[model samples]
Target: MKGKDHFLVAGRITWDFRRLSEEETDWGNKILFLPAAKNMSMLVVESSPWNANDFGIPYPTYFHPAKDSEVFEWQERMRSLERKWLFSFAGAPRPDNPKSIRGQIIDQCRNSKVGKLLECDFRESKCHAPSSIMQMFQGSLFCLQPQGDSYTRRSAFDSMLAGWIPVFFHPGSAYTQYTWHLPKNYTTYSVFIPEDDIRKRNVSIKERLLQIPPEQVKVMRENVINLIPGLIYADPRSELETLKDAFDVSVQAIIDKVTRLRKNMIEGRTEYDNFLEENSWKYALLEEGQREAGGHVWDPFFSKPKPGEDSSSDSNGGTTISADAAKNSWKSEQRDKTQ
Candidate 1:
């Protein structure tokens, strides 16, 4: 794959980067292929947090992209929908996981008069139902979108589809994950209540949402509604004519990225050297002044475990890859291929 313009779209599956042989990994660094996988690399478009070479993409939502007329019609309908609940949560509470704040959020929702909680577990079939989830979002002014098994969630887009402002608990949830589709000024479309605040019970989700003036909420919801077209995947059977959906945005960005990389390579520019690849996350957020601060708030979510640790779970609930395990697996695969 070296020096080739290859693009791999690992839709929804977090590609185990550990599965790459050492030679393959080296090739990945030198080449300019685009891997739309969860793993971070020099040229990746992922649903995970942004890195220097990794651009962010939105997770696929339930609905297909629509034409201008259909999009506008849906926007109007969302605007007209009656939101009876101030805030709502539709997820399972990770009770056993002490690090997770989901249980607290669920408890708060159940205790609050204006909050709606759809406690989803093995017994709850409603959580899996798109119609039921949409109904919950439509009836709520804000959707509590804490990190799921991963940093990003399809529910965030689902809430936006219903014109409900998403209340995120972490930057990775949306703020840094959808640069192409979401507005840079996060306040214009969504609310950020730090995960720490929820874990520590420092803020009330309902009260904080209530604190936002009705006028501001109106504007935020409208902003989210307007972002609908860009965040969706267009229907493959037909063309969208003028509007660009998620696929269009991602493809164009990837092309632009590759073009720049090719230009840099031709000119022998070392801007994207191996050092940058090792600390891509730092460069990705350099503009945000996190480089000077030495780290980011989401660092723990992506950091590897220290030596001799249990390694069963990290901060993000065992979503990350173990380097040794990945290397061994990659070697095994290489041996199999040779055989």
Candidate 2:
């Protein structure tokens, strides 16, 4: 697929995923979704969560009623997010980012916490290829699928392909994908938890996940292993569009999606320039306002200066809050912190 210059994205926007915690934790909902490009052959996806299991997906997919949603509000939030996300990421590298969830999860699995539970020694557990990653996911009984950036992610594909049941984190996400044909409980194939219920109901997400019946997990594994060959990107005769095309004629129809994406990459920046030019007045005014009011004030993590740096200086002389500064501010281990 990459030979045809296909832009296969595997992850979602990190910024948006963090935004979900701001929403209500529990709600049931659905959404209607349609792709922008033809056949969705250019930019396919498989963005599951780290804790859940998702198998392989090599097509342009969108979750209607989107992710990080507990109610109709999630649907609306996803609609707004999709435009800036999937379409806008037309030319993004195929989830090759160093900080991807897959990498972090693999790292965690080798570390002391999960490592001791697995009863296995860490083998450095690093894989240089996507296949290796898939193998790692397959070797396990349950694959965790955590929605990155407001939706379910690649972990779903990983689990389904490996015959592991996906342990879904978001409420109202999985069943909605199957048009409610699939069971939401551990009976049919998967397990899910409403995000808000974790803290309010005194639920231990990991404990509950570990408690899934072994028989149910085996059934889910069967479903996934059977589903993999058809869904993953591995077709020489027909490219990797077989599974989607099997569903509909429109699925295989090719558009100049890649070319258009490259073009947008050029055009989008120009539009941003025009927008900045249009709003230069407002930006200038805001800059002036910040100049007058500073210090450990309201915008500590972003607009304000660093704890030790001076804000008055420009890129060279100034001490601004860089991206590294923000990441460095986290004070605790995320799993140990109570909601």
Candidate 3:
């Protein structure tokens, strides 16, 4: 619906047929969701820049419950608890993918005396509880965070909730992502080790961690703990007037965006309509040739097709060509002209 209702979405959403049930799709327009497969309605909230760029939508925060309630007496205990290990990592191995770095980190932790590996498969009933993981974070100086399945994971935030500094292996793991939630000065509360250094044996995580002074570590830990309340999502039924949590920040962002959009539309309705016609993925999915090809609507990858160019088949059933293919084609044309 245009200019009337807006939708806010969080978490990883996919448009795979196998994941959808027959009943879910059969229901009429009773349900509204953030459009998938490159549909930007100006009403959707995305997860990351990658998702926003791919789908042409605004990004939103992935909210998680604050562990404050679960970890009773955490403030008093965390300050007093002796950190037994230099660093700790608690994640299962993804043996299926050789390129996955979790397996390598597990191996390194196993060999190093300072590294503590708390390996468990969440698929099993016993390993499902977050208590063991929280306890490990409480007893460790730094919590190792490697990107798993996606660029970001809930573990990094969880480690911070326990007042433990996070060590990231990839820029996508933290630095490049979560701009709205995390500080620009990443070193204030987190550590970054280039994945290449770990793979090349150029850096020792244990040695690097040990190099940090106790005072600096204490400061970082304090900052992490202070950030916990903001990063968390409290109960909606309770008053959130004073507390500016992630959910609050995300909702505010959406409101600002919608306000600007509505104002712009009101001032120049014809121009705005034209812009939407050029950029909107506003079409019936079942109807053929309704969607623009080339790329996702409003995405930079899209450009008006050239003379004599024709539409082609794609996996998405859209006439869109891959960005790389378009780049190569443009290069070929330039070379031909030069020749």
Please write out the lDDT profile of model 3 over residues 259-306, one tens digit for every residue.
Answer: 765676677643122233333332211134333333433232223345
lDDT of 1 at 91: 85
Question: Candidate 2 on 199-294: residue-level lDDT in tens?
Answer: 235354446655766566556655544443433333224332223321222133223434644576667732122232212212212332242222
Candidate 2, after superposition: displacement of residue 54 in Å?
Answer: 21
* Collision count of model 1: 0
Full-model lDDT, candidate 1: 0.67
Superior by lDDT: candidate 1 or candidate 3: 1
Candidate 2: segments with Cα more than 4 A from true spot: 1-128, 178-187, 199-202, 233-236, 239-339
Best by TM-score: 1
Residue 77 of model 3, lDDT score: 62
Residue range 251-277, candidate 1, lDDT tens digits = 887777667667867988744334434
Q: Which ten residues in a row have the lowest lDDT in candidate 2?
A: 83-92
In model 1, what are the clashing residue pairs, if there are any?
none
User: What is the lDDT ranking, best to worst?
Assistant: 1, 3, 2
